[model samples]
Target chain A: MPGVVVVGQVARDLVLVVDRVPEEGGSTDVRERQELLGGKGANQAVACRRLGAEVELLGVVGADRAGEDVLAQAAADGIGVGGVLRREGVPTALLVDVVGPPGVRRLLEDVAPAALLTAEDVRSRAGLLQDAGAVLVQLQQPGPAVVEALAAARGALVVADGAPADARTRRRVLDAADVVRADGSEAEALVGWAPRGVPETVRAARELLEQGPRVVALAAGDADVVAWADGHVVLPHLGEDPVDPTGAGDAFVGALAVALLRGEDPRTAAWWAAAVAAQVVGTAGGRPHLDPDRLRETVRRHRGA
Target chain B: MPGVVVVGQVARDLVLVVDRVPEEGGSTDVRERQELLGGKGANQAVACRRLGAEVELLGVVGADRAGEDVLAQAAADGIGVGGVLRREGVPTALLVDVVGPPGVRRLLEDVAPAALLTAEDVRSRAGLLQDAGAVLVQLQQPGPAVVEALAAARGALVVADGAPADARTRRRVLDAADVVRADGSEAEALVGWAPRGVPETVRAARELLEQGPRVVALAAGDADVVAWADGHVVLPHLGEDPVDPTGAGDAFVGALAVALLRGEDPRTAAWWAAAVAAQVVGTAGGRPHLDPDRLRETVRRHRGA
Candidate 1:
């Protein structure tokens, strides 16, 4: 099945559960620990695959144990790995998530391998990108690779998430993406002003639209607002208590990619994306356990609403 | 180089550096993170190999990516894996070390595959145990496997470290070992009384000697005291600042096993063990990088002292 292609970072996430943060020179006991597969691109790919979209991943993983583990997990999830590169003599990227109580998590990241991905790696997978129904890219990957990937997916629907750390990459992403999904903080960083409420978020999203994406979706507090040349739509909260919000944004982008590929209207697609985010935040880790039948049922229910 | 055979657990250690642990309902940020090879058995085996012993490991690792990584690390360190078992469907053991400032660390462990080790597995390698110069066992493994490994090492000098959590396994380990090593707290747990001073530690070591071991060494604060039927010896500290003391006890045990195989007297062997512990505590992680020549020079200097 031809599906959306995702290009970005892939990392091993170590989650440690602690009661509270200790002061300097003090120690706290870890209540629980788990190792999981994570990274923006990988999480979105897994989300798409779980929701029954034929998904392929384009990224680089080191020839280390963590890389091997990531590959094994991606394969188990049925995501296509034909575009994944295994680089030798490098360490795979890593993320350490220290979760305290509810909704409190501190992330420590090492993106060594992610930074090593080059434009050559993306250009080499030009065929895969062109064949994809839609291509999703997270700007957290190297700027050069993201640029090359965006160029390669010119013939396909390009959905971009995340603001690059630098102005050049941010402008490049805004210019290349058919759809851009950003949270309130990211929108502030990209558009130069923080959106306060739903009205302001739509205004901010329209400003982002001026930067070039055909559609701009900005996730504001308790609501998501999207703007395009035609008009704007405000999506209300799906009302699920999130176990973890780490992967919610990626889930939204992944589901949106699938919706657009299925020829849904932007308003309906944003609602579907919100549903996926709700399901994701209700689960542990970045990759939620998504059953395609249940997801379809939820979408059908939302359509009636 | 048919050297000491190490039988016990092998684990991947995820070390997280955090400020003081958070309180219940609180959160903290992690300062740093690392992944390293660990486990009582793996640490001791690596220590012996670094100290120039022809070391072989007898343990089980899951037939997963973590297991593959552990094997690669063991092979790179020149430790033998011929006796290592690859079990299907189980995860490799993992230890999460949440470290605060110096000497403040909390351990959260999962011994999944280690617990699956059985008596049958140990008996299968009886020939390797009997042919070894000495066999080192950590009671952290499954009780049945520990018992079988001890029985198989009857013809070789059996050095046992770590007290079993259960009374039955503790009795069995004490009965099977030629030399037993335990820290002051563990010695107290095994003997039913906490040793408060050097003299009490020696008395506790002698009580442990009466149980079955030919010699018992109890590591107390600042000194190590060993007791045997004839008499006892107190070894002074090598006087080094320990960077992390997580594996110092294992280093002492591994080095002492090597020394006994070389026919050194218990007093001299304990001194050598002290030197090894000093080197280990001065390094990071459980496995210290030891140069055989440097280790020998330090041992020689200790003897002269």
Candidate 2:
């Protein structure tokens, strides 16, 4: 099977749970902790692989031990490692999610310049990207790398997530991606205003569809709106007051790409993606535990509702 | 030279600095990050070694990569690692210090039960501790291990820091230690109440001296009091407001031990410790960077003030 290629950050995610944050100069115990393979790109790749896709992660990790650890974890998750680059003399990117009460978290992202995807790193994997069945480009990477991935993956289905860092990249993303997805704030950055409710989100999604993408999915307030040229569906968010929302968007996009790859209708794929993302909102950290059978059952139930 | 032995926690310290903590469901980039070997025992041992004393650390770390990393760091710092036991199948303790502007920090400590020193682990190093010139016991370890360390180091000049865990442990610590030191809250736990100022601290210090420790040092408000059987001196804390106080007490304890080992009088040694602690207050993490000549000059300036 020609694998799906995920182009973005590959990092170590450390999730620490504390009852309450201590005052300055005070100390508190971590009630729970999970150190795992994570990063938006890595998480999405994990989600894709979990849903039975042969996936390749095309991201940069440091040549350090943590870089090796995350790569080992990714391989254990059944993601291909051939496209992954280990940059020398740098530290792996680290995402620390310190979560407290529901929806309360402090995210400390240590993303060094060298840890980010470089244009050179992407070009090195041009053949792999070009040969992919589908390409998931996380806009968190540098503009050049994101554009390069889009250019290389012209032969495959292209899905872009998050707001482009600059206007040139944003224009290139809309022109190249088959589908584009963003959360509330990212939508504001992409389209000049955040879609707050059903009417605004649907309107914004249509405007984005006009830009060139065949479909656009956006998180607006408590609902997710998925719009194509003809129609749009605004689905209510599944998890109420999510415990943590770290990886929900990644899972949402992964599910969409996976569903489309399996030939599901765009509307059903969008609903399926929303359902899958709902599962992640309840868990800590961004890594998805995607069981296709369960997700299908959830989508069926959610559609009935 | 007979070495100074330190018994307590050995952890990987991850210090992250951000301009402001992100709200619930928000993200922020860490402006500065420092990952190093830290924990009270390790910090004090580093301090001792930096001050030109041979030092050995007696602690438990997981038989994991992080454990190896910290052990390697300790060795690089010129501290003996033979007594640093690697417990099987556990994770090295991790302390994440998230600092914002001056004096604001949120500490998350992930210290697994197996990573803490066991009585058996302490006893295995009995000969090394017994033959040491001095022993610094950080009270963060379990009562049994702390007691075992004290028992093993009966021939060494013993200094105990922090509040003993239980009443029985308190009694054992007082009886076994030659010197005792406690920060404000720890002092309150050691005694019934914390000392607030010079007079109250002096009275409290005198009271503690009767409990078997030859010298008692207590942090009281902005001042530190060091008292012996017949004499006591109150030194104003050198730093106006400490930027980070995670390792202040550890450095203080280390400086005291190093000074006493070099045949300094109790008052001058206390003054020296206070001066050294002032230097650490200006930095992040608990690791001390001690320079004897510079520290001596700072002590002279501090005493004159």
Candidate 3:
């Protein structure tokens, strides 16, 4: 199978669960904080891997301890780390998180560790992108450079999660991507909505059709989704209390990329991806494995794919 | 002599230097990165210790690995950590930094790990504050709560380093502080300024008197400072090519608190603090130390007090 190449926003997520948000300058009593192997690239790459897509992670991590942890986690997830160039002088990027009440998450992240990926490293890994079936990119790392690399690749279907994108960034990405995935808020941002609700989000997704992605997946929290490509489809929410929605979008994209690689129809692929994402929600962390049978069943029952 | 108290934001700081800031949508390469033990509280307390102040840090740290490092650094600095309460639940607070060319500093900080400080910890450390000759507070920690604690203290000469303050916070602190220190930019932030040079900063210092601080110390980078109290005095900056200015402010405040405890006149003490701060600028990292002779010579040359 042609592999899905994930690039951009690599990080080691340090997660902590505390009683409350530290008051403005007020401190909290931290009960538990654990380092989780994560980054936008790694999370989506892991998502593709667990959903049974051959995936390769192309990025640079430091030669420091966090890099070792990044390699270990990538290896465990079966994503290629060999392409990950290691810089001896720099430390890995870190995302510090505070998981607050009702599952609200505050991410304080710095993506500079991935910034150490020199032009030479990018040049060296250029060939890997050529062989992949699909390429996924996030905004965490530098976005334009990744776009330049994607522009050079002819074969792969480009999946862009224009997350963390502002007006200018989204415009830059809309031109480069084949499938664009927008979270509820991002969709609002793209269409210039004010204090958006479900209808506004739906209206925004419809307007995104002009930007030219073949498919646009807009994930609205519990309202599930309303998507339009050839026509409109309202997909049901997984209907489970999301243990942690940290990587749900990554999983959705990963699974979607995998289905697309398999040459499934867009609707079918999205259904399969949704089922895979829902199953992942049952697990506590991001990018949990999707049992082959369960993935198929959810696809058949809900996602027409 | 009564000891000194540093009441401010305390957390571990990770410092990294890169070639240039990442372009709006692009990435840049990092040349060096390091984890330096720091926090405004930790920096000031450690500075006081280096300058020979009997100092105690009154704050909360998480029970995680970072907290352990914070504890160890405090021990090494000879600052009492008994008041450094370790709550079992939270991870220690952290400051992430990206410093660019010409020594520009951007504090990409997350105080999540520092959320562990509780009201109880503040209450427990109250008596220690009351007995101190001087107390230093920075805006890195919660403002309102810290202000309340200072308001309750009667004996300590409260020196509020309002380097990073807002109108509301400045007002609250002025009500409780004996002296409030602000850099030229910070002073301008309170009362807008278009100062051209030394005269402008001096003029700026005069404007800060309208605020509640009995004295205002305005620090201009590597230049003479203008202080307003009994009378105006100009203490020249110790000339040095600074590699990193991370803890210079803390060093200044720490040495100032110590000098006050030693019963040095204010101008003489400011000179002592300037020397210590100059030493910090010469060093590559935070909280660099200076012994008795180094302190005395720097003071004697100034001929201020």
Q: What is the TM-score of chain A alone in each candidate?
A: 0.90, 0.96, 0.83
User: Mind giving the per-residue lDDT tens digits that candidate 1 earns over A1-305?
Assistant: 35889998877877766676555323455565667778888889988887778988898889987788888888888988888898887777777666666556666666664435689998889999999889998876778888898888988889988766577778888888999887766776667778898888888888888889888888888788877888887876663575666778888899888887888888778878878887887765756676666666776776566
In what order do the candidates fall by lDDT, top score first? 2, 1, 3
Off by over 4 Å in 3: A1-36, A39-45, A52-305, B86-91, B112-121, B139-144, B163-178, B188-215, B220-230, B236-239, B282-285, B289-305
Give the TM-scores of the predictions, in the order they appear.
0.82, 0.97, 0.56
After superposition on all C-alphas, the RMSD of every candidate to the true structure, in Å, is 4.5, 1.7, 10.8
Report the candidate with higher lDDT, 1 versus 3. Answer: 1
* Fnat for candidate 3 (0 to 1): 0.00
Q: Write the per-residue lDDT of candidate 2 for residues B92-137, one digit (tens) a residue.
A: 9999988887667778899998988889989889998989999999
Interface RMSD for each predicted structure: 5.8, 1.5, 8.8
Per-residue lDDT of A232 in model 2: 87
lDDT of 2 at A127: 95
Best by DockQ: 2
Instruction: Give the best candidate by TM-score.
Output: 2
Full ranking by DockQ: 2, 1, 3
| Per-residue lDDT value at A237 in model 1 | 60
Better of 2 and 3 by lDDT: 2
Fnat of candidate 1 is: 0.08
Cα misplacement distance, residue A187 of candidate 1 (Å)? 3.6
lDDT of candidate 3 over B173-240, digit per residue (tens): 76777776766556555445545567777777676666666666777655656465666666666735
